[model samples]
Target: MDLRRIKDWTLLPGASIEVRQQGRGVWSGLVDAVTADGEILWVIDPSGQRRLFEKAEFYEAWAIEERDGFHYEVTKNDDNLQKVS
Candidate 1:
């Protein structure tokens, strides 16, 4: 999987996203913005708290939809995974 392409996806404001932090909990929220260089992301949780995350902080991130919930399917291999959305 080309993680760079995933990171570069144009996540518009109000887009739903789920991020799994390394060795920590997961967070799901509406995307506030993705930095123009695709290095940082700002998300607003349901409680209205805004959080910032750098690309390396999370192990996985998925762009979600309100209707189907999650946009992609993940296939895992030895120490690797691919996302098919």
Candidate 2:
């Protein structure tokens, strides 16, 4: 029931996540794919780059869950992202 632990959440492609380090925006976008073991996540940043992120120390991933009154959608497989109200 908190952001500290999201292991229970099923991370899927197209999910919105904004990761940051040292109070700076690293990157945020719709998830493109996830490792089979769920240890890594691949996201397409705004610059059209495929970046890999691992849930570990010094990393914070923000997910706009249903309770947040917002959601994200990937219009197409190309990772066209849109935040829905």
> Which sections of candidate 1 miss by over 4 Å?
1-6, 23-25, 66-85
TM-score of each: 0.60, 0.54
Please list all clashing residue pairs in model 2, or write none if there are none.
none
For model 2, give the 10-residue run with minimal summed lDDT.
1-10
Error of 1 at 34 (Å): 1.2
TM-score for model 2?
0.54
On residues 1-85, what C-alpha lDDT tens digit does candidate 2 reach at each position? 2122134223546766666665456887777887777667787877888888776655555663444433444333236443332
| C-alpha lDDT values of all predictions | 0.60, 0.57
TM-score for predicted model 1 compared with the true structure: 0.60
lDDT of 1: 0.60
In lDDT terms, which candidate is top? 1
Q: Per model, state how many residue pairs clash.
A: 0, 0
